[model samples]
Target chain A: MEVLFTFLPKTAHQEKLEKEFPDVDFHFTYKEKSRLPSVDILVTYGEDITEEDISKAEKLKWIMVASAGVEKMPLQAMKERGIAVSNVKGIHKTPMAESVLAHLLALKRSLPFIYESQQNNQWNRKTGSSELFGSTALILGPGAIGSEIGRLLQAFGVRTIGCNRSGSAADYMDEMTSFEDILMKLPEADLIISVVPSTKETKHMLKKEHFEAMKKDAIFMNFGRGDLVEDQILLEALENGAVGYAVLDVFEQEPLPPEHPYWSMKNVVISPHASSHSKKYVDRALDIFIPNLHKWLSEDLNPTNLVNLEKGY
Target chain B: MEVLFTFLPKTAHQEKLEKEFPDVDFHFTYKEKSRLPSVDILVTYGEDITEEDISKAEKLKWIMVASAGVEKMPLQAMKERGIAVSNVKGIHKTPMAESVLAHLLALKRSLPFIYESQQNNQWNRKTGSSELFGSTALILGPGAIGSEIGRLLQAFGVRTIGCNRSGSAADYMDEMTSFEDILMKLPEADLIISVVPSTKETKHMLKKEHFEAMKKDAIFMNFGRGDLVEDQILLEALENGAVGYAVLDVFEQEPLPPEHPYWSMKNVVISPHASSHSKKYVDRALDIFIPNLHKWLSEDLNPTNLVNLEKGY
Candidate 1:
């Protein structure tokens, strides 16, 4: 089998794949090349792939996305080309969930303020420190990542309210609410976390009305796509005290633009979309991919986390 | 039936006490007045009491310390006077445990660096983000607070090792080790949390040898007592890269001197002895005190969390 990887794997991973799968012809490159026409399988982070590349790749049968967010991929082109796509979905559950808790706890414990105070040798004790225990959290899109976050939050005695499109019950959630009914549950949530995927229905899901329904001191975090809510609306909500604080990991624009108002906002925490960036990221993704490769070589081809290109999950 | 409170209670708490215990005479004061001799019971935060106060309180039979630490209170004088003492020991479990997690997550997530980058309009993706998952944590003094911390860490898949006077098993801990065996376990801990009480046995518990035994990147947190390790030794550990980071919530000196090097060190996170400070602190402490008060009022006199005067727990 001829395979192409657009992203570089770690040296150990490279060694493992080359050593273990000696029958497969592997090519790794970032430069534009003619290898696309002959590639049978392509692995990527879903960011660099384009519709042009998809059109030229006549031999490509499968696209293995190493990252969870496959929104950037040319889903329509791949669908037309009959390319089967799979992502490392559950691999992010640990790192992403840990990131969510990190932001939540840091904001609640006033670590930013404490860090600032330390620079000035200030011993101010009035940090407005609060407990995660007994607080209510509304988690949008309670999939693997959200469920993991809910489980961790519950360990601290937090009430987890899971919100999804189907209003289906999920693990570790105290209650379930559909996306349409999120506003009704908004007022009760001390924290509102967005982990919903990027899709037609989910785009601009959180409008001004949703922010208005939230408590004045409610902490809002967006670990999902940034287009879930308009930046201006979130800014207005924060400025007017409709929402107390925001921990933003993803943004509508990459690098967030130097002149963005969020950079200057005291209540805003910008993470440069690095929530899922871990040393073990590539290793975990390959763990899922390597097993699927074995299944494909055996002619089963029943890969886990096969993405429905139309639904865009 | 006369009761004296050294600290002021919330209006709701005062109203509840006044309305419920109508026959009991309650006096709230911070002034050094002559109400000590007539008091049958005293309520304090264990900080303001002294040997002179104990000797002056001829009619005082019991001391209700509204805090976990009784190290500040004249335990010797109270024992000599045959005065009974009780403290709200378990009330700190929730907030303190949450604080420990807050510091851990904040450091692991590089919030301090993120905040700095935000201030400079730098969109840096290399945050060195790490997960609590698969990490090992050694918790010193796995009592109520440590057990609570262990439970929360366990949810994140962290291996929790509990250390106390006895090597007895504790809730939420994967394994149990005595303090004597801490050096052996130190190398395996990614995080070492101190929640031990301030006592002769625990004084200077983490010394130069202990720091040398830890992993190069091990994170040390002191939530137990400031005097558990000297400032000089900890500073040396951080300077020499023997320890990666230190989150100090307690210090040997209050309002840690302006000239202290810890304030300027990037690897050090300083919290002004405020980890236990919570909005619900008094309410939770009173929850334990009020139920115990019923026993005292009914001539039972026995209280929950009665301190062993000699051990100073």
Candidate 2:
């Protein structure tokens, strides 16, 4: 069988893959040229993969996404072509969760202001410094990534509230609330972090009214899909002091155009969607992918993170 | 009985004190001009209290320090006069520990750089973003504040090494080592945090050799006493990359002079000694002080955090 990687892996990883599957034809490139039609398996980050690429790959039976988010991929086209898709889902929990805490602690401790003060060689102690202890956090989605974030936050004595579709109890969360009932819980949360996946139903989940329901000084963070809230609604909330601050790792548009108001907003922390970028990321992804590859090769069982095309996770 | 408060308590706290001790006179002022001679108990932050002030207070039986640090207090005079001393020691753990995490996370996530990038409206994703997981942190003086910091860091999957006088096992630490043996563990620590008290034995604990023994990329933090490490030694380490970064909340001099080299260094983050400054500081300090006051008034018992005059904690 032929395996094609649309993104360049580390030289050591390429060598390891070649050694592990000596019988398989392995092709690695950002631009996988003539072998596209003959590719039996495709591994990608799901960013550069398009509907046209799916149509050209006649021999492709399965698409393995190295990253958790599959929203950027052509799900409909893949579904129509009867292509099986599996993604490394829980791999981002560690780095992404750390990123959440990094932003939360930085903002809460007034590090941004402190750093700015350092630039002017000023030793200003009136930083409006605060602690995370006894504060309430509302984590939307509360899946693998959110639960990890909750676990870390709870360690610092933060009361974590996880929100999901059914309001099922999640590990490390003090309370659980349904997505439908979030409005009732908004005012009590000092922090609100969204880690929900992208989908039609999940799109624009937080609107202007949701921000209005929150406490005036509440910090809103979108580490999930950018479409979770309309950019304009969040901007208005921050601009009006309805939401005190925003720690954004995702945007409605990738690279978040230079003209975007968020870049200039003092209350907004832009992370350039780099929260999930870790040196160990590829290794962790392969830990899931390689084992799944073995299971797929030896048996007919589906891989662990097999995505449902209609749900689009 | 007369009690002198050199620091202002909250209006509500003042009312509470007056209501609780109606028979006792409560004097509040920065300059307790005429009351010093009549004062039975002095409640101060210990900064302005001098040996002369202690000598003037002929009626002073106990000094109720409202802060953790007693290094600046007139301990020699208080001890000579047979006056007892107590401070709100453990009250700083929550805010101080949270501050440690804030600085560590900020540096690890390249937040200072990210904030600078935001100023230029640059969407820079090449931030050397890292996670705190599976790293080693050497906590010097794992007492109340250090242990709390260790507990929080442990929850993030960091292996904590607590160093103290005896090197005895500490809560939340994976390993323990004596203050003398820290040089051996320095190379293994990705983060070194000093929370040791200021004493003759503790002063200049981290000198040129200690910094030389540390990992080249290790981050050093001084949240303890400014005298724990000589400023010149730390400056040399940072200048030579012997220490990768320094997060300082304490310095040899208060309001670290504008001419200080650390202020200009890109790798150093100066916090203006505000890590322990919390909105709830006075409340937490009062929580310890009020109960102690009741015990002292009803029964001639020593307060919970009664300091050993000779040991200077």
Candidate 3:
């Protein structure tokens, strides 16, 4: 079987794969190529792959996304070809969930204001710093990462509500809701975390209407794809007191422009999409890949984290 | 039964107590006076009461500490008098543990820097942020809050070790060690959170010797009493590259003197002693109090959270 690996040009992961699976022929290429035949599996990272490249992989029986989301992949073509798709879903869960909690705790405990005061060498002992206990957390996606977040939140005694495609109760979630029911539960949440993968249905999911439905002092966090929310609407919400504060780890564009209005917003915390890029990420990713590779070599029909081509998760 | 409520200027809590138990005669007095007659129970906050005061109350069978710790209570007198001393030990567990994770996460994710940069409208992005997954965490105390912190860290896939009085393995701790064994484990920790109360043994526990054993860039946090660590040693450690960064929520003397060097240190994040003070505290404290009070009144030896007068936790 011929396997094609597509990613940003920087890694020895392909070399490691070649050593482990010497019998299987492997080709390494960038995501921009127009055609690639005899490829049984194509692995790509981030949102760099084009639909044209995906269409040309005529013999591609499976698509292995190196990222957690398949939103950027040619889902329609993969579905038409009856190709199986799997994603590296749990790889980013640890760092992303930890970052979400970091921002939530920062906002709740007034870390920003405290740090700012510290820079001025001020020992201002401000009162009314809130705690996470008894706070309501509404996680927008209850996948492996979201469930892990819920477990962490449960340890702090926070009430967790999950929103997913099926609206089924997860182990750590106290309540479950569908996407349409989110507005009804928004006002009750003190913290709203967006972890849903980018999809046609999820794009602009958290718009002006959703923001308006949230509580006045609610904290908003986005560790998922940026396009899932409308940035301009979020800015307006932050300005008008519809949303108290926002911690954005992902953006519509990488390295958010310095002149962007979000840079100047005091209520907004903008990170350069580095939340999930941790020192241990490569090792952690390999941990998941090694076992799955073994399973694939044995002709396993179902991959561990099979992605629904139609759903784009 | 005569009950003495100690502390100056009692407010709504005392009034509520008065209304709830009208049949039991209660004497509310300031900490200065020692004229209270023999009482069956003594309820007190953070005020020093002499052995003479406990001696006067010949009928005092139980002491209920309004505060979390009984370090200031006349434990010797109570022990001699054969009076049971109970404290609000687990009440602060959720909030304090949350604070520990909060600051640790904040430090690891560069929240202080991100927050400050956001204020200046700067879009600075740094790489190689650390993740909690596969990281080792050494919790200095395995009390209620430390154990709760262990549970929180478990969800993030961190290996949690704890130090305790008996060196017995706690439910959430991967390994439990005595004070003498702490140095051996320090080199392995990526994060060290101190949640130990200020006992004679714990005071200045995280001093120069202990800090010297930690990893080069390890993150340190203290949600425990400030006396558990020496501020001067911590400052020196940070300066000499022994400790990378610290997040302190408690201080030796708060409001930490405005001229303190920590206020000017860039790598430190200091907060007032407000980590355990939350909106839900009063209700949660009452939840424990009401149930325990009923048991005490019924003479059922309601030893739900009996404090060890010797250990002083």
Docking class of 1: high
**In model 2, which regions exceed 4 Å deviation?**
none
Candidate 3 docking: what grade? Answer: medium
Name the lDDT value of residue B104 in candidate 3. 76
> Fraction of true contacts kept, per model?
0.77, 0.74, 0.74
Candidate 2, residues B1-313, lDDT tens digits: the string is 8899998887898998899888879988875556799999989988889888877889899888888889888788889898989999898899899889988887777777788888999999998777788889999989999999999998989999999999999998999999889899999999999998899889988889999989898999999989998888999999998989899999999989999998888888898999998889888888888888898898766888999999998
Question: On a 0 to 100 scale, what is the lDDT of residue A135 in model 2?
Answer: 95
Candidate 3 achieves a global lDDT of 0.78
In angstroms and one decimal each, the interface RMSD of every candidate reads 0.9, 0.9, 1.9
Error of 3 at B166 (Å): 3.0
lDDT of 2 by residue, A266-286 (tens): 889998898888888888888
- What TM-score would every model get versus the actual structure? 0.98, 0.98, 0.82
Stretches > 4 Å off in candidate 1 = A31-33, B31-33
Local accuracy of candidate 3 as per-residue lDDT tens digits, A84-157: 88778888877877888888876776677667677776766564567887789999988888897898787777
